[model samples]
Target chain A: MMDFINFYLVPGITLGAIYALGAVGVSMIFGILRFAHFAHGDLMTVGAYFGLSAVWLLGIPALAAIPIAVALTCLVALFADRAFYKPLRQLPTIYTVIASFGVALIFRSVVQLVWGTESQVYSVGFQKPIVLFDSLRIATRHIQIILATAAITLGLHWFLHHTQMGKTMRAVSDDPALASVAGLDPEKTIRWTWIIGAGLAAIAGVFVGLDTDVHTMMGWNLLLPMFAAALLGGIGKPLGAIAGGLIIGIAEEICTYPFFGESLISPSYKSAIAFVIMLLILIFRPRGLFKGRLL
Target chain B: MELSGILFYLISFLIMGGIYSVICLALNMQWGFGGLFNAGIAGFYAVGAYSAAIITSANTPNHVGGFDLPIVVGLVVAGTLSGIVGWAIARICVRLKADYLAMASIGIAEIIRLAVINEEWLTNGSLGVSRIPRPLEEFFTGRESEMVFFVFVWIIVAITFWVAHRLYKSPWGRVMRAIRDNEAAAESVGKDVQSFRTQSFVIGAIFMGVAGALSAHYFKFFSPDATEPLLITFLAWVMLIAGGSGNNKGAVAGALIIWAIWSMTEIITQQLPPDWATRSSYIRMLLIGLFLQFVLQRFRAGLFPEKAPKLNVKSHG
Candidate 1:
């Protein structure tokens, strides 16, 4: 039992952390923007590519490549905001959503055109496994993932709770017009939100690349899972996304172990697993697990 | 390259446009009237095409190929299957938030494609089913077969358009539009918003299914890859958005113009230098993407916006 638990549960948690990062970004963006940014998954893919490029160009350690990827991703997010999203601020949310889909398609095709529709592997140079106990072993890379996710989550918590910009962000998310009247530039706040959100997505993407292999369809494939996580956690809540991701990840992983004579659900269906959970949750409580508004 | 060639291409374009017009009209009913962003239309299209192909093609001795059913039966079955899938999706997804619904629908679409690709026993895996029988082959004979097929497809398109128009003007259409504009308000008036939207979605999907069957019969071949993102789903979105989201006439018009441009560009690009042509396809997609963004930004109302239907009642109180 412990062996089974360690093999499935621990890895699930780590994978969940990566999904949580992406989900938080999606949730925050949805909260503030009032439309789903469909291009976000592609943005994550862009970040992974940037990380891969950084590793190739600088010949730096994979650990060091992550921060560089994050910075580059943040820059791209800022640019995308200016070019694609900002102009559509006054339009209806539906139009913006469609626009985001266009942005995502453009981003995907560009990636495909550049990368040649092939899967890429980024060697992080960490091969050692840390044995946790008697029956279970974990990879050092997974440890890095867990630590990185924890640090980012804690850091975001601190930033949201203690910082002025964070407070303004919260205010903007809560009520944009009210925040605007209270001397916050809603545009600037939203831009910063995109930067932070996209930055987190980049970090998650790079980490996921390190954990597995990077592919052109990596982001596109993850879009549904991220959306599921975001929806599961309540659309606007960061903490909710984290918990939601963990639940989805662990549940899907554990589901791989079939009970009785039933066929085990394959890992390829991981995205579908997350979506099914999301559907059920939406049916029972459309507001989500945290009972928040449908941002 | 002669006058006859031009005429032939024009006729082909009209036929192709007629097929796409059916797709765009279906999408219009969903996105325009119902405000449902269905990114999974491609999946339904694939299902329809494959259903028709598998049904009409003669089954080989050593392989699963087709049932050799009648063409009309194949078309109906395709549409029915697609409608069933749409109904299932609507039952599951119509109650969710708009964005969540879109995500779910897209997921469903992806799942369908994956299943079709991976389910080797049923769909013959990636090799795809082919040799679908055409309707009216006996009457049309050899050279005139194409013309007869075009007429048959155009008749179906016309009937679909007529049904769509009638539905739009019906009381159910009013409820669908109201739901699209403001769901909360519609709910306040005691309407079963979910059911109405689901009906619209299912009906639209049936039309799309029929269109897919038509395409399969016309092409006489199909593969799982044929139902990929660009061809099935996004192209329909482009046609609908370009035409006018809320107007059937606009949707039909948009599909023709966009499809014509798309086909011509594809042909022209193919004739370019090999290296340049290969890269120009990417450019073509980029242009479409940019066009989508530009149109959405500049003219959300579309080339031919739907004029609000005149109301019969006026009150002074």
Candidate 2:
């Protein structure tokens, strides 16, 4: 049991936390902007790279660079929306989706140009794990990631339920027409959506970087799973995205566990788990688990 | 450049342009006619490349079937296999909204990629399938053989173009236009929108598979590198959009023009310092992405705007 907790469960939770943060952004964007936002993954890459830049330039710890990463990623998101998406608002949503796909390539290419294609670690070498409850072993970075995600989730909950802007965001997401008729500025709501979504993606990107070496494809690779989580939790449902993310993240990791004296699945095929799960959901629960808007 | 060098380059360009034209037309069938957004052209392309490679290559201990069959047989199997996969996916995802379908199709393509990479016994993994035979490769050698192959690819392109045009003039084409323009109205008129979309998806997939097979034959090899989304999927999308989505001629022209630009840009990028070699490819990709943004915003209908198909019979009121 301790072995299971140490090897499978802990890593799963850590991964789940990262997915939850990313999925929050994907879900929010899908709800508000009414597009898939393919570039959202690359936004995470941008955030992680920004954090790396801060660490390289300011000599700050990776954790200390979150503010810079979040801010820059938010800026990128807003600029992308303004330049690429806003014009296509009158066109079909697929136009924006196609544009977002292009934006994804653009962001990744820029990152590859600036940072080189090679993977880099946020911090040098590995840290020893701290023993918890005498039998459990956990890394300090994992604790930081999980706790930070929890804190963010709580903060998001408070903001969404209590704040004026948060409530307006929810209203806009639920129905842009009704919200606009209620005298809410659609543009303002969109700007806020990008800010929150990109900010969370940056943090998730940093967490991924903290856990493993940061590479250009890291965020792209994670994008599908984050999307799966968003769908699983239900689009437009922030809390549901959190739950969805945790389930998918944990499911992906735990699927490779050795349940019957042999691993249940080869690690090489582990990525397929999310795709399969997502396919099943699309077929049976097309509206999503939380019954989000069909669009 | 030397005349011979230029000639070789020209041959290579035309051959690739011909292959991309077939791909662009297949995309037109799906996106233009059916209004289905298939972002995973690479997936169908990979299936074609691998299946063709396995069926026609000389026997080898490295991988599965080197059946040494005729190239035509290989091409047929490639299309059949890919069409089946497309059918399965369409059955599952055809009802999705356009955005959802795009995401799902891309994911399906990724899964296909995963299978190609991991199923080493079938695909030979990252090393890819080799010693594949090109059609009429045995009859000629050197530049002459290439010229022959060039003719072969263009022949396929011609057939693809003809089929696309014929469909445009057909009654089925009219119904598809109705569905594309207004799905609810098509459904209300008793046209099975879902079934037509599936047929369009399968037809497009078969052609895409054939296009992939042509490429594999052109190179005399097959690998994951050739199936890169940037080169195959995204480039096709750019070509179709740039050429004109609904027009068959536009699809072909777009493939040629975009491909010419893609090929010629390499000469400029190759001039950078050796240290900037890797960075140059990224720059090229960035340029392409930016180009896509420009085209989407500025050129909505493309150079060849889609014209309404000529109706042969007068409808009685």
Candidate 3:
């Protein structure tokens, strides 16, 4: 039980938190812009890299660089929207999806050019785990990551419920035609979507970097799981995405646990867990868990 | 640089081009004719390549092999297996929106990749299946066999092209186009949109598998890396879109041009400083992405836009 708590449960929750951050963005972009936004994982990668840069230059802790990551990632997302996606708004959503794929490649290549192909840690060497209840052991960084995610998720709930822009975003996503009639600026909602989505994604990126080493493929590797979380929670529902991410992140770690003296699957096949879940969700409940729009 | 060397290189180029042509043609049937968004071409391509490698290779201990089947048998099974996979996914996603389906396809591809890399007894994992034979290896020696296989691949390409062209003109093809343009209207007109789409997807997958098998025979070896999505899926998409999506000629031409660019870029990248060697592939990827953007922006219709066949009309005199 102690082993399960220490090795499986804690890691799962930490991963879930990171995935939740990324999924929130994906779900929002899916709801508002009306495309899958394939470049979203790349946005997370950009954020993490920004955090790495800040840590290297300013000598701040990785966790302390979250604001920098969030700011820079938001800028990239906004610029990507204005330059690549805005022009194609008049066309089919598929055009935007393809362009996003291109944009994903662009972001990754630029990262590689600047950061190189090798994986780098924010600060090398391992930290000792903190013990809790004289039995459960957890890393200090993991605790920080989980707490940060929880705070952000709570802040998101507040913004969505209490703020004018957040309410307008909800209105547009829920019913674009009616929202247009109600005089909501779809473009304004779109800008906010990028801001919120990218901001959260950057935080997620930094969390992932702190947990492990930062590399070019970090975001792409996590993309399927983040997408799975978004689909699981229901599109355009940030709360649902948070729930979905926790579920997937936990499932990924727990599946590899040596239950019954045998791991359910090889650790190498961990990503496939999210893939399978996404497929099942698509086949059974294409609307997602939260009654997302069919399109 | 030398005449003989250039000739050999050209043969390899054309053979690879032919393989890509088949895959592009398959994509044309899906995206061009059927309007299915399958971002998982690598999945089907991997299925085909691995199946061919396993079926034809002689007995081996490292992985599942020893079937000792002929190259043709391997190719056929490759197509069959890939077609089945396509049918299964197409059946599941028949009612899905194109955007959603595209995302799902990427997931499916990732799943397939994981399976390939992990299932060692089946795929030999990363080491891959070796000693796979070329078609009619006993008849010709060394370089001559490459020439024979080169002819063989083009013959297959021609057959695939003919099939795609015939399907485009057929009444079934007409229904597919109708569905592609507007699905609700097609359904209203009593067309079984689901069945037609499944057929297009399966047919296209069959050719892609056959192309994958052809590549296995050409190399006389197979590995997971051979089916990289960037090389197979992304390149094929770029070719089809650059050539012209609904046009068969455009697919072939697009494959050739894009393959040429892909080949030449490697040469240019190789000339970079040794310290920059590892970064060169990323540079190539950046270039391809940029090129795709240029195509998507400037030539929405591609280099050779679709030219729908002229409808016959009789004058009333």
Candidate 4:
């Protein structure tokens, strides 16, 4: 039991936490922007690379480098919105979605151009897993991931509930027309939305980078799972995203268990599992588990 | 460049463009008339490529492929299988918002690509399935083979285009477009929007499958790489949109023009320093993205919007 918990459950939770961060951002964007924001995974890649840059340039500890990385990524997201998405705001929603694909390509290609195809680590050294219980061990990075995700998630929940800007963001998401009628500045709300969403995505990217290595394709690989979580949790509900992410992460890791028999189900099928679960959920419950808005 | 070299390049460009035009036309049918966004063309295309390869390729060691079926049979089987998959996918996903279809299709594509890679018995893993029998290979050799293939591709494209044009111009096509423009309105008028959506989706997918099979025959090789979303799916969307959705002529033209630009960019990138050259594809992708944004911002309707349907109204007292 301990071996199973250590091998699958712990790592799954860590992966879930990272996915939660991304899913929340996706949820928030869907809520406000009313599009899937397909460049989201690429934004995570940019954020991860930003964190890597901070570590390389300032030689700071990985954790210490995250704030600067998050800030820079937020700015980058804002720039992308202004440059690409803002112009097509008045067009059909599909236009924005297609435009998001283009942005995704641009961001990914830029990452490849700048970083090359080689993978990089934040602090290149192996630390032994810290024993939690009898034969149950957890990595230091995994622990950091859980704690950081918890902190950010909680922060987000508090902000959405308690703050004026957060309320405006929610209001815009709920109904832009009503929010504008209520004298809320939609532009300011959109700016805040981008900031928060991009900031969370940056943290998620950093965590994923820490857990594994920062590669150009890392975020692309995470794209389906993140969207799956977003859709599963309910598109606009951040809390739902958390649950969806954990569910997907656990399901993916669990699919590789020996119960399937060795070599019958390769670890490579983990992504397929995430998507399959998502498809089932979508098929049975189109509004998602949390009953978020149908749109 | 030598005349022969230029002619060869042009023929190759046309052949490639012809294959892509079929894909674009299918997309135009889906997005233009049906308002359904499919982000998994690459997946369906791969299914077509692999299934056709399996049926048509000669037997090989350590893999499955010995039937040596006729090319026409391979194309039909590929189309049928892909259409079935598309129908299944649409049945589940079409009930949701169009955006969800995009996500679902991407998932489907990824799953298909994954299957192609891991299911080595069929796709032959990384080695890929090769030696796909080309149509008219016996009589056509050398540059003549290229010419034959080019003409063959255009013939297929033209036939498909004509069929698509007829389908969309039909009353059934108008109903599909009506459902897209206003689902509730169409629903109130006793039209089954979901069924219509599925039919169009299936039809478009069949075209994509046929295109994939045609491409496999021409290239004589197919790997998991053939199904890259960026290369096949996204590029198809760009071509369709830029050429003008709802116009078959525009789709064909867009495919040709974009293929030309894309190939030209490749040629230009080859002259760069080795280090930079390695990253040129990424740069080209960035430019393509920028181009898409530019097109959307400046010309949202594309170069040619769908022609307004010519309604035949009789003056009846």
Candidate 5:
């Protein structure tokens, strides 16, 4: 039991944290903007790269570069909205979706152009796992992931519940026209939403990079699972995203469990597991777990 | 270029264009008429290609397929299976809006790609199935055979085009367009909007299957790499949108134009210095991204807008 918990459950939780953070950002954008931001996964990659550059140029600790990366990614998201998405705000939602695909492509291409196709690590020294029990071991990176995700999620909850801007943001997301009529500044809310959303996404990206290696394809690879987590949690519900993310993470890891029999399921099908779970959820509950808008 | 070289290039271009036209025409039915967004075009295409490849290829000891079936039988089976898959997907997701369907399709495509890669018994794993039977392979060889296959492909594409064109002008087409314009209005008029959406989606998937099978036969081989969504699925969307959705002629034209640009970019980029060659693909993608954005922003209705159906009655004013 300890071996199973250490091997599968721990990593799963860490992975879930990444997805939860990313899904929250995705859900926030979906709620406030009412369009599937397809470039979002690439935005995470951009954030990770920004973090990598910070660590490289500033000679700072990998952990310390998180704030710098988050700030920079927030600006990029803002600029992307103003330049690409804002121009087509009046168009149909499908148009925005297509534009997002284009943006995804452009972002990915820029990453490939700037970073090439090679994978990079933040700092190369390997840290031995700390033994928690006779056999159970935990990596420092995994611990960091859990701690940081908890802090951010808690901070987000507080912000949404207590802060004036957060309330205004939620109001706008619920009903932009009504919120505007009620004296909330729609543009300001939108800007702050992008900031918080992209900042969280950057943290997720940086942590994932730390857990594994930073590569141009990391975000693209994560996009499906992240979207699954978002949709499963309910498109616009932030807390639900965390729940959905954990479910997806556990399901994916469970597929590789030895009890299943090695021939029964391959680890390569982990993404498929996430997809199947989401599809099944959507088939039964189209609005997802928390009753987001059906569409 | 020499006359023979030009002829060869044109034949190759049109053959590729014909396959893409089938895919784009199918997309026109979905996005243009049905208002359904499917991001898994490549997935369905791969299914068709692999299905047909397995059915027609020579039996190998390592894999399950190798029935060596006839070309027509393979194509039919490919399209039918793909249509059935689409039906299943439509049943599950037709209620959702276009973007959700888009996301779902992406997931579906990735799953299909993964299945193809990991399931060695069916797909032969990464090695992929080879020696797909092309039409008229026995009679002609080399470029001559290719030319014959080219004509055969165009004939199929033409038939598909004619059928799609008829559908576009038919009453059913009007219902589809009606549902697309306003689902609630169509529902109020007693049309089963959901059923029509499913039908259109299945029709589109069938066409995609046919397109995939045709391309697989032409290439005489297929692997997981050929089915990348970024290359096949997104490109199909670009073709349909650029050529003008809701217009079959525009769809075909868009396929040819994009294929021309695609091939030209490849050739041009390959000629650059070695370092630049690696980067050229990214440049190509960047340009395509820009082009798609430009089209969406400026020409949402596409170059040739869907023609308003001619009303028989005269204006009473």
Candidate 6:
């Protein structure tokens, strides 16, 4: 039982932390933009590729590559906003959503064109397993993932609460027009939000790739889980997104171990677990678990 | 090239376009009329295709197959199953607003795909159930078979379009449009917004199912790979968006135009140098993406926008 718990629960929390990082980015963007940025997953993919490129080109260590990738991803986000999103700010919310789908497809196709359709593994060389309490073994990579996620989450919380720009971001999320009237530049705030969100997505993508090889489909597949977390936590609520991610991750892991010996649920269906959770939450409590304002 | 080959390609393109037209019309109904953003239409389409194929194909061990049900019955069952799934999704997600509904629908679609891929006992796993029978194998063979299949599908498409046209002008459609434009207003006006949306979604799924069944029979093969993102989901979106969003005629026209361009470009790419061919395919996808962005940017109303019928209110003196 302890062995099973260590294998399943520990790995689940690690995976959940990665998902939470992606979800926070998604939630933050949704909070600020008032539209679901479908291109977010592809953005994550782009970030992974960027990190891969940096690792390959500069011979940077895997740990060092992450921050570089994050910076580059932020730039990409800033550019994406300037190119694709800024023009559509005046359009209807639905239109922006649809346009984001277009942007997502473009990003996906571009990635495919550049990287080819083949999956590539970027080995960060962190394969050591740490012994925990003489009975449990945890991967060093997993520890990194959890620690990185916690640091980022705490940093984001602090930034949102204590900083001037963070307050402006919150104000914009609460009421864009009102925030604009109070001498806050909505466009700049939105640009910053995209940068921050996309930057975090890159971090998650790079770390996930470091833990488990880089693939073009990594970000696309992660999109649903991230959305599930964001919706589970409450749209636009960062804290909610993190908590939701952990819950989804743990639930998915637990579901893989079927109760009563009915046969283990396949890990492929782990995504379905998140979907089910999302559907139930949306049906019963559309405001999500945290009951934040609708995006 | 021989005239017969050219004719064959033309006829085949139209037939395939007919299938897409049916799918797009269903999407138009839900999205254009009812304001439901269903990103998972392909999942239902895949289900429809697989359901029909499994019912009619030869049975394999560890699963129910080789039932050899009639093609029409298979089609109906596919549509019904898709409708049921859609209804379930609607019950779970229809109450949510547009963005949330879209996300939920997409999640449901991914779940369906996952189930299909993982449930080896049911769907034969990724190997997929093959040897699906055509509707009229004995009467038609070779080119004749293709032509006959084309005509049969065109007939289905025509009927679907006519039914959709009649339904669009009906009171039900008006309520759907009202809900699409303003859910609160429609609800205040005594329409059960949820039920209406749910019913519309189910009906659309039925049409999508039928389209899938036609595709399966036409191809005579089924696979989990049939439900990939670009091929099934994004292609449908492109067709619907390129055509007029709300107009059936526009949807059909858009499918034909896009399918024709897609096929022609594919053919041309094959004739090019290997390096160029591979490069051009990516270019083509980029172009499509750009075109969608361009349309969204410039022609927000689409190629053929849905014009609201003017009410001739008599001058109040």
Model 1 docking category: medium
TM-score of every candidate relative to the true structure: 0.92, 0.98, 0.98, 0.97, 0.97, 0.96
lDDT of 4 by residue, A87-191 (tens): 888876878888998899899999988888899999888989888656779888888888888887788889988999888887887777899899998788888
Model 4 preserves the real interface contacts to a fraction of: 0.77
User: TM-score of chain B, per candidate?
Assistant: 0.95, 0.97, 0.96, 0.98, 0.97, 0.94
- C-alpha lDDT score of every prediction, in listed order: 0.83, 0.90, 0.89, 0.88, 0.87, 0.83
lDDT by residue for model 5 (B111-149), tens = 889989999999899999998888888989999998999
Instruction: Please provide, for model 6 over B1-317, each residue's C-alpha lDDT reduced to its tens digit, 9 standing for 90 to 100.
Output: 89999899889999899999889888887887787888888888988998998888866674567588888889899999999988998888777667787787788789888888888888888888888888688788888999889988999899889978877878888888888887889999899999999988888888888898999999988888887767666777788788888887888887888888888889989999997788788778888888877777777667788865544569989
lDDT value for candidate 2?
A: 0.90
> lDDT tens string, model 3, A1-295?
9999899999999999999999999998898888888888888999999999999999999989989998999999999898889988998888888888888888999999888878888998889999989998999999999998899989999999999998998888788899999999889899999999999999998888899988988888888898899989988888889999999999999999999899999899898889888889988987788887667
Greater-DockQ candidate between 3 and 4: 4
lDDT of 5 by residue, A200-244 (tens): 889988998899999988888888988889889887778888888
List model 1 lDDT by residue over A148-242, tens digit each. Answer: 88998899989888999888877777777788788998777787888888888998889888889888778887887788888898877887888
Candidate 3's residue-wise lDDT over B226-298, tens digit each? 8787788888988999999999999999999999999998888789898776788888888898888888877
Distance from true location, Cα of B241 in model 5, Å: 1.2
Clashing pairs in 1: none
Model 5 clash pairs? none
The digit string of per-residue lDDT tens for model 1 on B79-193 reads 9999998998888778865776688778777777777777777787788777777887767765478777888888988998999898898888899999988899999999999
Q: In model 6, what lDDT does residue B248 have?
A: 78
State the DockQ, from 0 to 1, for candidate 2: 0.79
Which of the two, 2 or 6, has more DockQ? 2
The CA lDDT at A83 in model 4 is 93
Off by over 4 Å in 4: A260-264
lDDT of 1 at B49: 86
- Of the candidates shown, which would achieve the greatest DockQ relative to the real structure? 5
Better candidate by lDDT, 5 or 6: 5
Better TM-score candidate (3, 6): 3
